[model samples]
Target: MGAEENIGGVAAILRPVAAVIVSVSPSGCVELRLPSRRRSWRCDGVGSAMWIALRQHDGRIGEASEMLAGIWRLDPVDVRCVMNSWAAELCDAGFLRLEK
Candidate 1:
């Protein structure tokens, strides 16, 4: 199955896994660590921004996309697509979980 299918599409709610450790640098770099899985992921630039926005918006993809779209002056639909894709990646990597 595809990432989108696994995540139940763009409207899916996502939250960081409770056991995962997250850290952000002043330079907008993000690090996610799942000690149980012995896995870690690092994000910078747009990825970092998206992660921050996702957390700020309480895992609401639409709200995060809107915030990014406005700041980047990009189409909302395009921003949403990017956000959804990124979210799916994070979910598959086990740093995030689907809430609904």
Candidate 2:
């Protein structure tokens, strides 16, 4: 695996796991629920966009980011950074797992 796949790379496929549940509001906000931990997280605008894109694309991070960049009219570099950070956080939280 390349660095991207090894470390929360944009190329890495990320999915909601570990009993985590994702919900989207009618207004387009995204929320995450960790039932085991009894905790919840509300994603900001950028995160909402990423989450939706990831879900639509079968957890393909790089492809999701690219699609989000075009849809949101944001810089690709910024989107990648957010994706990397978000993926790392999810991995650490046990909400996301990488496919071997």
Candidate 3:
């Protein structure tokens, strides 16, 4: 109903659809062998939002969160929850920095 919900809905649909093009399979998997998706990759809530948000940002969590919040009119607190969780996961995975 709101812009945030619209953005989230669009994101929810687009990412999974686009993930077909978004995902990389460099493991020598065959054209037919690649999975539609893995069970573990499905996520929800702020964590899922964060994951999609960060991936869409070219890996820039800060700008992604700000843009995501602005475009969606979501509360900063909610946006922060998405971003912080994403940053934490990325950091744990050795993919992102604490400050940036």
Candidate 4:
């Protein structure tokens, strides 16, 4: 089974739109929602990553780069910075892992 399958098709919904797989934690997932609605999703993942990260995801491919930068990592923040330029289009989809 794939990561999504392993996670119960929850993150699967984000595969198409997500740039990188952010950390998944017990609280919830940090993915971008890509539905035709303005309301997106957000992730409450673990680590200091989330503390400084925004707990939301969006489907707008334009903002992927920015989202990646704010991912609580010290990597190149250029792409992430540019991605934030479109924060309006981004959606921070939050999902709870299905209880086994």
**RMSD to true structure for each model, in Å:** 3.1, 3.3, 12.7, 13.7
Assess each prediction's global lDDT (C-alpha) against the native.
0.84, 0.77, 0.47, 0.36
Q: Tell how far residue 10 is off in model 1, in angstroms.
A: 12
Residue-level lDDT of model 1, residues 1-100, one tens digit each, is 2323234454467799999999987876999999999999999789999999999999887888899999999999898888888888888899988776
Tens digit of lDDT per residue, candidate 2, span 1-100? 2326655544556778859888887887998888888878788887787778888989877788788888879997778778878877777776777764
Off by over 4 Å in 4: 1-27, 30-75, 82-86, 91-100
Q: Compared with the true structure, what per-residue lDDT tens digits does model 4 show for residues 5-97?
A: 234434322223333333434555654443444444453443223322333443322234355555535344554443333332332332222
Residue pairs whose backbone atoms clash in candidate 2:
none
**lDDT score, residue 82, model 2?**
82
Ranking by lDDT: 1, 2, 3, 4
- Top model number, lDDT: 1
Q: Better model by TM-score, 2 or 3?
A: 2
Lowest summed lDDT window (length 10), candidate 3 = 11-20
TM-scores, all candidates, are: 0.85, 0.78, 0.41, 0.21
Error of 1 at 55 (Å): 0.7
Selected candidate, larger lDDT, 1 vs 2 = 1
Model 3 lDDT per residue over 4-97, tens place: 3233344222122222222323642211111444422323444545656666766555556787788789876677665666455444433333
